[model samples]
Target: MSSTISRSLAGRKARRRRSRVHSLAIDGNDCMRQDNIVVEIPTSTARAATMTSSSDPIPSLGQHVDFRQRFEEEINTFATSLVHREPKYVPSHQEDALAMARIDSSCETAIDHWMLAQSFGCVKATDLTEGAIELCQLLVGVDGCEETRKVLETLSAHESVSPKNFLRGLCAGAITRWVYLDTKPQLPSVCQYPQSDVLRSVLAATPNIYRRLVDAMTLEYLERHFATTIPALSKELTKRLHTILTNFRGLKSANTLTDLSDHINNFRVWERYMADAFEGALRLRLNHLRSPMKYNYTFPSSGQPFVEDKMISLYSEASRRRPHQVWLCLSPLIESWNESMDSSSHVIISPARVISS
Candidate 1:
């Protein structure tokens, strides 16, 4: 079976970026889990207090409830163009209802979502660092919005929504329920059984940083550089791998030029030993399958600022020293492939292409 991943550099383009979060370390997939914290909203004692007195000034009497159709007509006429995201739904005749609406169930939530959406600060499709804070606010807002937020918070808490995407893979409805659908994973080339497809989806949604960290933990990066080799893979494992590769193919970063260089350099080395070991192990372990192979890669002595081998080794060394980053063991499945007739046979780990902004 062919396992070559395509790396097309013909259409390269540059984008602008400003960096934050100094020195990012792969904090393992599970570290970012947002579980174990309970956000409680205080009960509405204000309403109870207001109506507590039996000696209320006014006599108890029924108030007129207006007809819906007539009232809606007035409200529509009085509506402003600014209502596109107008804070609340206002009905003119029921000034009382409009007044009540003004008092946000979770005034904080509406404002937070609005600010992020307006400022464009909270629209990250891949990373959830900014979005999670916004999500937490909306999920535990007060008043009528309380119930809805409570429900989502319960689910998020139960699912253990991680600031990291590692736990996200464990959730079944992340793309549909949490993130936008455009970022969902798919079979880049072919379809598979429902159960297998589900597994692929989970892996696809998972954060690669954590995935690599997991591998580093289990495989212990530097213990053995990836030997030039080949391996055979089961059809089931291949499908799961294909899904991961496809997802990573579109991964983009909001890092600066220098940051991107550092990360890319780290990955370049990661590819060497990690890729080699993964390929070597798979080939040696599953030679019984139909085909296995390895690729011949030669990097220029002074291509860019980053040396591929050195960065890979450095990342491994740092990863091993830290204890929380053990998830590297769950690295992607390696599949051997044929790059070209003249080129040596290669083991394909993924189709990851880092996009910089």
Candidate 2:
């Protein structure tokens, strides 16, 4: 309901066109008919008798027979049904938790906080420790005192932290910095590279890198929120996945966000790149097998939209890359998506893309 693209001019125009093409065609004059009622009455088999005991006179207590017998009969009927019924238990396996679309915590913060984080270069680091430390200092300075002995103490003990460890710890440190700097909580800067609006703009244009960042954030977001319904939650996860990664082209290379003529021409190129990454990732997903998600019977007639941006199928791209693990966890999703029998006879992906049968 609160979609950004959903609220766009193009979206509105499409909706208006749809409304015109599919309006109701009700006949103003209506016809009605009434049918005669045919009822059947059953013949009486026996006259029911209320038995009573004189000493304990069950009917004496109320108006009918003993309540005990009636209760027993009811219990017997319930037991009979129970004996004939199949037992059911909730399925043990559940779909992976998915995140809500666009509700990124960093995005939720006020503009000033984002600006402060940006100005501080919180987003600049490939690894977050240095950025975290600087932000810690800035936060302490903001409080007008440098009781940042806590940060100094904390920073001194990190002699052997890896880059991965650094980002997580850096995120934690940013929280600490925000706590020390102000009376309120703050967004961590580890998510940002180059820690500025400019860097963010650049990253947004680079579809591949931007997607990795979003995927990480999406996991973090999902950890904070899990949903049980498989398909509905899956749909939401799909949407979030798409939003987290974007096709980021260097904006300066182009002119504006709405450089329509260029975008129209280069749009397919964007989609193809994303599709290539996805297909590559699916190839990576070949070996490792986790337990199958209890194959959900209620899969939106398999018509559920793949409304998500998936990451590149890179097996830890780096100097010492583990090519074997690259893209291992992606194929099942793509395979499912590929075979989904949506009524449209087509399964569109990313709007700019489609995987049709």
Candidate 3:
């Protein structure tokens, strides 16, 4: 009975020793016993082990996907808000038409001033008369009439018509006759697409893109519509001058002969000027295409009634008469075209400058 009690006491002592060792391992002490080996761990390492065991697990694949989706949703919402913002303002058709009219008027006025200042000023009536007399001497030689000389002398002395006015009138008349009567230009058929509300909205939203589009369109239109007819017109004018020179004596006055010489001289300067002017006008016209508007010019025919709104009388007498027919159109009327919800619309920007009978 004593031996049995002693064995029971030993078993209890061994069990208690194992319990104490398990408790010490869980506490992560600086020194521990495992299988009778002493293991030493730093306080920091023990603390890190404890923390690593107790902390939350690493994020899962599903959680990562959810986070990405939320971020993308935020980005999409920002983009949608930007799209709904107020669009940039676009000019109305009427405003564009008026602006273009102003530009055209200003350009023409500048050109006229330049022509007067540069080419016309250099050629005096006396110089023209002398050139005509020389031409007559060359053409008629010994057969030249004394009457022709007297007519030229009289014309040079006549101060009633200023040289500037005379030259300008002559140039205007010749250009009008050539363009409208001799060789009228046939405008090429341009395939124009009307702008939809959506497209306009897009353009209005992005100003840089809109500008680039306009520039490209203008350039393309110019490339296709450049005035090839101008060279032909110039050639025709030269031929006409030659014909006029051949029939010099048939002229009503020696003023005609002097004017012819002035016209020839002016043509040399006008060649480059006309090309530049046409290009500029075409560019201006194309720039307003965003408004879906069309620009055109109307050349008045002879014997057409001279309405005040549609025609400007070059002669003081025609203005005084008030009710006169156009004898000649010095310049064409510029018109703008637009389409309404119901019908088409036409507005004249500038009137034709005319000589009336």
RMSD of each: 39.7, 30.1, 19.8
The Cα error of candidate 2 at residue 287, in Å, is 24
Cα error, candidate 2, residue 177 (Å): 31
lDDT of 3: 0.46
Which prediction has the highest TM-score against the true structure? 3
Structural similarity to truth (TM-score) of each candidate: 0.18, 0.19, 0.35
Candidate 1 per-residue lDDT over residues 1-357, each given as its tens digit: 122222222222111111111111121111111122221112342224343233232211221245454544433432332122232322222332232223222222322332222222212224333334233233223234344344344433332222222212211112112221221222222133223453344346544422332322223211122112122222222233223323223334477788667655644443332233333333332221212133221111111233222222212323334322111111112223452543354433321111001
Q: How accurate is candidate 1 locally (lDDT)?
A: 0.27
Sort order, lDDT high to low: 3, 2, 1
User: Residue 262 of model 3: what lDDT?
Assistant: 66
Residue-wise C-alpha lDDT for candidate 2, range 289-308, written one tens digit per residue: 11121111110101123333
Residue 247 CA error for candidate 1 (Å)?
2.7
* Angstrom error at residue 274, model 2: 10
What count of clashes does model 2 give? 18
Over 4 Å off, model 3: 1-268, 284-291, 316-318, 341-345
- The better candidate by lDDT, 1 or 2, is 2
Order candidates by TM-score, high to low: 3, 2, 1
In angstroms, the error of model 3 at 62 is 18
Task: Give me the displacement of residue 96 in model 1, in angstroms.
Answer: 73
lDDT digits (tens) for residues 1-357 of candidate 3: 999999999999999987776555455435433455344344576456543333423332223456545644554443344332222443455654564455334334434543432432322223334434343333212224564454434432334324333333343434434443333233333224243353355355654444444444444444344343445545555444333323222213334676666655654544445434333443344344323455555666444687888777875444456656654454567666664522357776667776565
